[model samples]
Target: MKENSTFAPKANALQDYQFTIIVPVYNEEENLPRVEKELLAYTKIASKKTGILFVNDGSKDNSQALIEETCTRNEGFNYISFKENRGLSAAIKAGFDHVETPLLGYIDSDLQTAPEDFNLLLEKIGEYDLVTGVRANRKDKFVKNMSSKIANGIRRAFTNDGMDDTGCPLKVIKTAYAKRIPMFKGLHRFLPAMILLQNGKVLQVPVQHFPRIAGKAKFGVWNRLLGPLMDCFAYLWMKKKYINYEIKSKGC
Candidate 1:
């Protein structure tokens, strides 16, 4: 586990929180304001009692201050800050570990995925342990789109998860199942596969995608290409050694 140096949460924040959306921020200072606005609007119209958890992955910019300010004024918003950059998977894992709500969601701070579309995924959450978005007509550069396509194709052949766009940032998962997943580096790309390892059902729904309005993309061609290839081998190894069991009966 990475060091979580700061845990700034409102007292009793989760008491009435039915869902917590984990927003992983890494040097996205330029986009925090809009992120706050979009998320605030989503909270107002979300079907469930929703809260926002911004995981600051040791951002080396003003992102920390912005996240603190956003969480301070927002009633249901909170944050966990790491001592150093821990990447997206660690941030999501931290969110899963700290979430007190029954349902947990995840999105990127880049705002390429709309927060409002979460409702579309939530609609089917009752039937599946995890419901993720499949970006419809992604608005990204040709290199990025092609690399992501190749990566996703390789992952499907390896894991056979049947997810069209695992890289889509929008997702909703039952906290119980999410918490059980043993997260590792690049595990963010394998949420559905990891849920399947727990014998949980996963589904994908088409969602809106937008071009990044601010800040630069974090991943490049190598990260999108070689990264998933290495992670696929990691998943295979994890699947082989993974332990899962069900207790038919328990004594209280």
Candidate 2:
């Protein structure tokens, strides 16, 4: 991945961190301040030392300004902003492409998932190739929540990945597996399944969920339901021809 519009990596300060959390931002100016506070607090007690990488997905708002300001004030905060608005999956793909940590995690700028709970996923990373969250007591509205449930069911039927909450943004994965994923516009919904395609294991643990305290909800009934429904067919096509191999004999 090329350097984003602007990024200042402080190697001396970042050398101690063993993990990175990618927070994808898109017109989320209202949440950046709280994201800064929560992530900084998380770094203090992360199971493995961690830092934050804010991927600005071309927000046509003040999000990029706020991200730069936060990165300047915080010790381990850094960011890469896009030149034009891309979807969430593109931001996640950018995160995977640039993250250089052994363990890479992703969270939403909306703050729906708690950063502290990253530890919960981190604890199980040693045993599984991927660790994702299943939100316990989600705080979304009744209609939205119901749509999500139906969407998840449809996704499971297609992917058969057995993940109850692929919609949950909180997740940690080995960087090796993450970087290998063939990312597309909506492939974020199929992360666990993609890992499975690589003959890897996945574990889902319950994590805390919060209602949107700021910014408008980005998705509606159409994208929440119909979007994943469409991605399912895409996943099926990829799964059929996807190849995985292990070399047993090598001389170097």
Candidate 3:
């Protein structure tokens, strides 16, 4: 779990850190400033000591420079820049691999989802292994909304996860359960389902949503609709072979 630490490392164990908000960025130069501002503000008032981790998903634009700048300027801010763009799932996988905090969170670089809603997810973590958001009033076009609905319905039928909006950007998950997920291309859409495969509990709570303030949406109908539908087959395959274990006895 080695990462580039710009500032002093925590004196206590990883559990001492309450949460590390992983914001996956890919060519989101216009949104970095607001991302920094909102996340920093959230950290200030967060019930737990929250840290911001900006995962630069091989962004070719000026997003990396601004991310580095913002991370350096803030105390609890940090980041990892990939050599090449690997899409959202890879960036999120990297975040889950490196994040050392007790709770792991994810938000989009685009501010369509509010950072403050993370507090709501955190409140439910004690009762469930994963607590994700369902956008109450999604601010998207008719086409996008309908496509997502169709996709969600298809996924629910396949995985039986019963998640309304797996596409929701805001979520808080127990680090152990999160790190165990076998992430793939459309991994973000299957987070709750993956948690269930691990025999972990999942709970969804309604959260606020807004239209994109900056940068165009990275996913379109193909990725949101066709991609996830294809991933459902993969999920079925995984679920058939998924393993679960218990350490009734152990020796070092």
Candidate 4:
């Protein structure tokens, strides 16, 4: 509930902010300094006024202290800490639950993706409910890239969402649509599909990608390959049972 004061800090106040960029951190102490620098710069040139929300997924390292210090020094940076490790899906879900902006964005703390490219996605968000980045000239290893390709192919066959790279972390989603997504394990892989379930428009724009400059990657080839394959089945189940209803009229 730590609302960024760059906009409106008090309840029932009109928030001037247009977006909240959620950075999910988990034992990424080595990269935090650079992350702070890049994101702070991005905010200055962003298409709309932006706030940073760091969801600490129970990092055992010195990340929480750094996050606290960053928030304290910055005008629009804030964080929420979990009591224990809950994986990436939980971190993202917590972010969605707490975000109050009109638009919400997601980015990894690893810095593989450029924060500045967010403006590119933001430019198109008005016409779509979700705008996700497809990594252009991805700089990952062969195994990593190949595994992701296979996973994406399998996901396409099942979900048929027409997304080239659903694993891209750089994305901007309308807050109303994002909050409706029922997050599960591997929720990140199926974000566009989830938006489709809500009868929302989705677009994928190419963005810059880089190799991991710091911190160990949380996922391996097996994690990248097998985990998403299993999650596709989960998505199928959820899709079958998901409830979507629209009321043309409402009562006060």
Best by lDDT: 1
lDDT of each: 0.93, 0.90, 0.86, 0.90
lDDT by residue (76-112, candidate 1, tens digit) is 9999999999888999999999899999999999999
Candidate 3, residue 123: Cα displacement in angstroms equals: 0.7
Q: Is candidate 2 or candidate 4 better by TM-score?
A: 2
TM-score, ranked from best to worst: 1, 2, 4, 3
Q: After superposition, how far is residue 192 of candidate 3 from its true place, in Å?
A: 0.5
RMSD of each: 0.9, 1.5, 2.7, 3.5
Model 1 alpha-carbon drift over 4 Å, by segment: none
lDDT of 4 by residue, 1-252 (tens): 233211223333225688999999999999999999999999999999998989998899999999988887787788878777888998898889878889999999998999999999999999899999999999999999999999999999989999999999999999999999999978778999999999999999999999998999999987788888899999999999999989999889
Answer with 2 or 3, whichever has the higher lDDT: 2
Each model's backbone clash number: 0, 0, 0, 0
Off by over 4 Å in 2: 1-8, 11-15
Residues 37-80, candidate 3, lDDT per residue (tens digit)? 89989988887899888888878899988987887788777787
The numbered model that scores best in TM-score is 1
Q: In candidate 2, what are the lDDT values of residues 1-252, reduced to their tens digit?
A: 354444556653555678989999999988888899989999998889898899988899999889889988887788888877778888898888878889999999999999999999999999899999999999999999999999999999999999999989999999999999999888899999999999999999999999999999889999989988999999999999898999999998
RMSD to the native, candidate 2?
1.5
